[model samples]
Target: MTDDLDTPVLDNHLHLDPRHGRGIDAVEDFVHLGGTHLLVVNKPSWHLGVEPDEPADFRPVFEETIDAVDAATEVLPGRAWPVLGVHPGLISRLVDERGFEPEAARDLMQGGLEVASEFVADGEALALKSGRPHYEVSDAVWDASNAVTRRAFELGAALDCAVQLHTEATEDLTDLAAVAEEVGLDPATVVKHYAEGRLAGVTPSVMSEKDRLERAAESGEPFLMETDFVDDPEKPGMVLGPKTVPRRVRWLVENGHDEAVRRAHVETPAAVYGIDTEATLE
Candidate 1:
């Protein structure tokens, strides 16, 4: 991601995962290359290094991170746009990953994310006295946790922000799609990673990911791509997806799927995340 590259890039989904530092340098490199703004995604509390003992203090610290990300915007091309904070995986994907009691993996994974604090607020606890709780954890915790996330998304969106999310299960990408619609995406602004339904239904023949990207052309939902590019031959346990996204991009460019690729970032995602830019090179 250098400034010298003529290709326009929109990094719609980079984790400001606090496990990582402020991405100021990376942001500058992209911007210098004539890249436009990024849609900064928030890390879920579970992803924060905070331990369980300090669980209760979680939401405030979550707030602080958003503040920090917002501050970075002042130095960006424009004030950087933010995604309201929440890890959709907190309730589903993360929980399953943690080896929690194998809850029914529905449209999304279940069990929810780890928390830094136990729920203590009385009124906040009251909201979930009934059924169908939305909190990633128990009913008692849902109120406050849900509030923090809602507020983060609200503030970010009000600022014309875009939300970045990780789907809980591999097949849950469509659910993320549904969530984007619910968030009132304006187009091209919504972003989901590891999308393209490569992992839609794990099997033997679904092995060729590039083939899957070609198949996904019909659905036309937009996506973003990134690479930690981790390839460990010893860890065949890891997903095979790392090889796919960039290949898909080049494939799009080669096969005139650039319009399809561009739609995922600029138009469809922009509308979903409320982005004002076209995500194209000027």
Candidate 2:
């Protein structure tokens, strides 16, 4: 499986939780199946047992993500870049578990994003991650989550990097694109993680399922491919497996979707994240 393809196979969103999951071994699974690159995203702070009272508290979470990226780069066949930020669902935790007001929760998330942005600025990470809750929430909490997402967009604009979003599953992402535009960030650089298909205005990091991959590939528009591999030991392959993207890329190629492979794995990621996918593959 690893010998047939010459083009880069990049997974746009993945997580590595060494304390609780397969960690670098999961990354090895990806590379062994022919994946050439990864955008290793940060898990939620609470997942890492970090309770943030202020911005500086997010450092350890971001550092953990960076460390995972470094470890993957050190031992894996492909490259791994860090994407760090506050998980949108953290707003719910802050309000419900931490006893923070909605507005205060939003502020703390924004501050956490600020710290994540500094990592991008310092070249420790490639992009910033942010989004609203994927489940039902109070209107105020939803508003706060959006505010935090907007702050992420602002930071992405300042750093000239990509922003990976983890929002509710939706077919239309025109509203998210509008927010990116309002924040002076290019909508093309706003990636909808766990995306099902090609969105109208925003970049879709389509999940590597046959149906979704077929739909996005058939669209012929620039898009990215991801597994959203949570890498949790208990749930083991909760969202998707690490080898899914590379395997899907092979499927696309066999189905004569070479252009889609180039667009999703090479062109789109390079344009959005400013990484030389071809060079990295070499």
Candidate 3:
């Protein structure tokens, strides 16, 4: 079943927060659909409804993320990878919803990211997920959000780990990369999550769209493919189904673009996360 596609997919972004869907079954189902690797992200304030005061407060969230990935790895072994961090959206939530002061929120977020960076250093997770300037917040919150996000990148640089970005749809990447470089983090390690358009230096984790996939394939751009499956039962398959990336890979192969599938699904993720695809499958 896994070899049917001949090019196994590495789902770079997925949420298995237990509150959203059947935890281990979703992973097994994704594996059955020809997915070989999964980067499971933890959503603290988003899914778990937790507020951050200090970095230690985020340890429980990171531990939960580790437990989820460990459970999946128990089922699928090396195929499960964890991505732990304070999601950018949480910045706004803390400021606006929880009535937290901007500085306090920023401090909490930075502390949480410090904890995530430790996990990355310990090899328990691959990346610290954070991004600049969630566009929907108020002006003050937006400014504070970008400040905290910048600190996360600096933490990544200090820890020598990758950072996964979640920002607006039309956000620019050059400025983000500049921030990364200024903080001593390599721009190449910064991944734009749920990306739609092309960028100059940053790597995008694209969804399964014919035009988007074709453009990425034709441009010879270095990018990874993902479904960004939220796995929420209420809005099941909202962004895309679990099999979306595998189906898109099949579509590409059928259309005589097998090499593109290999680059996007296999080579790129392996290089980015430094994981062995075959070892994961085994």
Candidate 4:
């Protein structure tokens, strides 16, 4: 593959946990491989050693995420931005393991998202991250998770920021788009993280797999690329490695997919996140 470093490569969804992962060192690895930008999302609350009993409890979790972004920025300059919110899987954890009622669990998650919105309002973060669990759950828990997601959409609409989603694997996102429409949020700004292919509705931050990258490149769709690197030291490279995005971009360009590179790495991200990817390069 080509080793050109001119293209602005952005990892749309990534995490840096200093407590349990390589943290800033992992970000350095990504940058060394030609990555240029990142949307550093928050890890789960429990992962940060915080068990939220109220809305304010999420503050520490979000603060840690912002801190990580700050650290990454010091390493990569203005190329990293934070996307904070309550992880939707928290609903199941609250209901099943933490002995919380479904409705109460939903309220807690919504409240946590409200706290996260304040961060976006203060310009500490670029976008909000929220979505339903990617696994099967009881109907009550499912409904509660949807409510929390809708609250996130409302918050995003008010802040005029994108909402990165983490949900079940699906090619069709029409139903989720409907939810965003009902909440009066732009469906185009709702990014599907870990997306495998061209989703029917909403923006797709396609995961950096060789086949998926090739398909997204061949389709010529306006999409973004991400590694979704968990950065967990225990399970290193569990989701995808941090270097995957830039490496995939090189592969695409060498395979005569320059247009896809421009769109995925620059155009689409600028359109969705309202940030100049090229500016960071200069």
Please tell me which predicted candidate would have the highest lDDT against the true structure: 2
Candidate 2 lDDT score at position 155: 95
Clashing pairs in 2: none
- lDDT of model number 4: 0.88
lDDT of 4 by residue, 1-282 (tens): 223567888899989998788998998888888878899999988888889999999999899888888888888734789999998889878998899999999999999999999999999989999999999899998999888899999999988999999999998888988988888889999999999768888999999998888888888778899888888878884989888888888888889999999999879988898999888764
Instruction: Provide the lowest-lDDT 10-residue window in model 2.
Output: 71-80
Per-candidate RMSD vs. true structure?
9.9, 1.1, 1.9, 1.4
Q: Where's the lowest-lDDT run of ten residues in candidate 1?
A: 122-131
Name the lDDT of candidate 1. 0.39
Task: Please give the ranking of all candidate structures by TM-score, highest first, separated by commas.
Answer: 2, 4, 3, 1
**Candidate 3 — what's its lDDT?**
0.77
* Candidate with the larger lDDT of 1 and 4: 4
Report the error of model 2 at residue 205, Å: 0.3
Clashes of each: 28, 0, 0, 0
Per-residue lDDT of candidate 2, residues 158-208 (tens digit):
899999999998978899899999989999999999988778778999988
Residue 183 CA error for candidate 2 (Å)?
1.8
Error of model 3, residue 199, in angstroms:
2.0
Candidate 3 least-lDDT 10 residues: 43-52
* TM-score (C-alpha, index-matched) for candidate 2: 0.97
RMSD of 1: 9.9
TM-score of each: 0.48, 0.97, 0.92, 0.97
Q: Evaluate model 2: give its lDDT.
A: 0.89
- Residues 193-267, model 3: lDDT tens digits: 887636566788887778888877876767788777776778785787777776777788889887787778767
